[model samples]
Target: MGLLTERGELEAERLTPAGERILRAASTLFYERGIRTVGVDAIADAAEVTKKTLYDRFGSKDRLIAAYLEQRNRVWHAFLDDQLAALAPQTPADVILALFAALTDWMAESRRGCGFINASVELAAPDHPAMPVIVAQKQWMRSEFMAQAALGGFADVQELADRLLLLHEGALVCFRVAAMEYAPEVAHRAAADLLAGWPRD
Candidate 1:
């Protein structure tokens, strides 16, 4: 079984028109209002579909949550890809720093912080259908950092990636949870300095 289907959930791409509407509504509601608080009823009301349609499309609220997160992962990657293309980083180091630079703009509109982090907090159960999606989202970031570090011939790629991920995630939390409005700027500067002083092969 596929990762999503291990729990018997429908994939996000096979949505019908009504399914699309349901997912669109769920994604907005889940992000705007916490996932735990929003119900299938609200999603159905927002999508203007019956609860049965929502179930038929997603199979369960848990599955819908997974699809919401999967959709978010795609959106985030696309945004980052656009940023990277626009930045046109000349070196691997530039690529790494560009990621930190992108974070400031990415969080400009939302005060809720990282959606994956928020979802992880709410879906504490390790076996939850959406847990893998949340974990994969984060792992992807770390892997990107590690890949860039390796490409740059930086020593200790694993450690470097870990440190970068820490700063990246910390800034996200501080921005929302601690109300550090300039948290992303702080992270960017920290990443730049870290890269500058980092050991080369």
Candidate 2:
């Protein structure tokens, strides 16, 4: 059977220590070095496994790239979930601004802007195996933001989501461009003001 399929590869019966090691190494290598830059040989050496073993387990470099992106998607969602959980019984302004706070905290220790964003830039090919993973992740994030906006009592949840998404992404770009740490705070305030001026439900 061809390795690339819509459902993705079957889960192995059991993962060996080496398999786990390979995943761990891939996690670091793929995030630190761009996926295109980190070849199978690099992954094998870092995991102390043979290239054949890597292929036997994952089928191909493309599959491994999908796996790596799936792993990262889970991590990014988990971070957003954690933030949402902290703000349960959500208030309008606080919940909205909390996202900004979360972004601020994330940027301070993130070391780089975002693994998914960085990887997407490197994988310019539209049909790359990792592209669906990126699109799915981003759609999920937008959904989460809309859900939060609803919880915060906004009549225009989608609009708020769009605005917040723009501001949030803008803060990341500004942070990268300006090499400044305060952009998130400013964005958060601006977001709060936008919400405040809106006609309330």
Candidate 3:
């Protein structure tokens, strides 16, 4: 299935023209400014719609934040898909490493770092409407790592996935929070070394 259809929730095609505009505006604002800082009024103004239209489209600010995250997830997955196609990794291990390699370009395109991580930090409420979307995004990465490790016949796939996820998220945090310019490159090399030394079944 296509990326839009994969998640089966809030696909782009399902959105109305106003909803589309609202989402487009919200996504950009949320990423650039932050979820907590941006308001529905600002999003409506950016989208050239009224506050009533924004509320009618998204119901509330919380749902709008969730929609923004969902849209981001789609964009991220599409980016990785394009990278994997271009790199054409020969093995599952190579595929895993290719994801790390893609991070450099991904980070370069947007120095703001992972949107999900930023949202998680800003949305402190565990019961927040967007919390599940944020958590699922990170979990999907870990799941992908584990699936690739298993495909490569790696020993202790769970443990390997956990380690890879830590390295991946750590690099994202360091890049933005600590201002490590070469963080993604460093992560790529570290992943390569980790894969090289990882035991195979």
Candidate 4:
């Protein structure tokens, strides 16, 4: 976790008020603009801090990018956890299928596109600092699907989780790249169809 391992030390390196501003500013610019395009000068200006202050906090652009993904993953996971917790009393199908609707809402608000996906594309090198954060976010999603599928009593939990995760990934890709409109709804319907095809015990 060299880069991500730094994450384990977040509490020790908790941001100052100015550091918070730097992170928020970077998050918006990096996500809205491509990661490579948004320079540290731009982020420092937006955050209303000196370039030296930015460097003091983040060390370098790579570290800042890693922090952004970690921040994004944190917020995204909290949102998902809240959604699933609220769905606790509902049918497992309802809980599992809420992903599409969630994506619809998220995409509607985050029109710039998937933050992690954007990072992946912008930072193509496999060893890029932000790569691990992106990988962890995706793996967490698939793992969450597996947990929900098992609780849902799906006949094939792993298979079902895999298909559902594919639908989730496909919907995001469609929203960003392929079919922009009607993507989430189409994925939702397809998820329902998959649910129908795979009966639970």
What C-alpha lDDT values do all the predictions have? 0.88, 0.73, 0.88, 0.79
Q: Pull out the clashing pairs in model 3.
A: none
Q: Write the per-residue lDDT of candidate 4 for residues 1-201, one digit (tens) a residue.
A: 110111221222489999999999999999888899999999999999999999999899999999998888777655666665655536667766776667777778788668998889889899988898888777766776777677778887888888888998888888888747678888889998998788777
For all candidates, the clash counts are 0, 0, 0, 1
Candidate 2: RMSD to truth: 6.4
Candidate 3 residue-wise lDDT, 49-95, digit = tens: 99999998888999999888988888888898898888888888988
Estimated TM-score per prediction?
Answer: 0.93, 0.80, 0.94, 0.88
RMSD vs true structure, all candidates = 5.0, 6.4, 2.4, 4.9
- Candidate 2 per-residue lDDT, tens place, 86-134, comes to 6552464566677677787778876666676777888888898878887
Choose 1 or 2, whichever is better by lDDT.
1
| lDDT by residue (tens digit), candidate 1, 41-160 | 999999999999999888999999999988887777667778888888888899889899999999997768899999999999999999989887788788888988998999999999
For model 1, name the residue pairs that clash.
none
lDDT of the structure predicted as candidate 3? 0.88
Residue 131, model 2: Cα distance from true site in angstroms: 1.1
Clashing pairs in model 2?
A: none
What are the runs in model 1 whose C-alpha is more than 4 Å off?
1-12
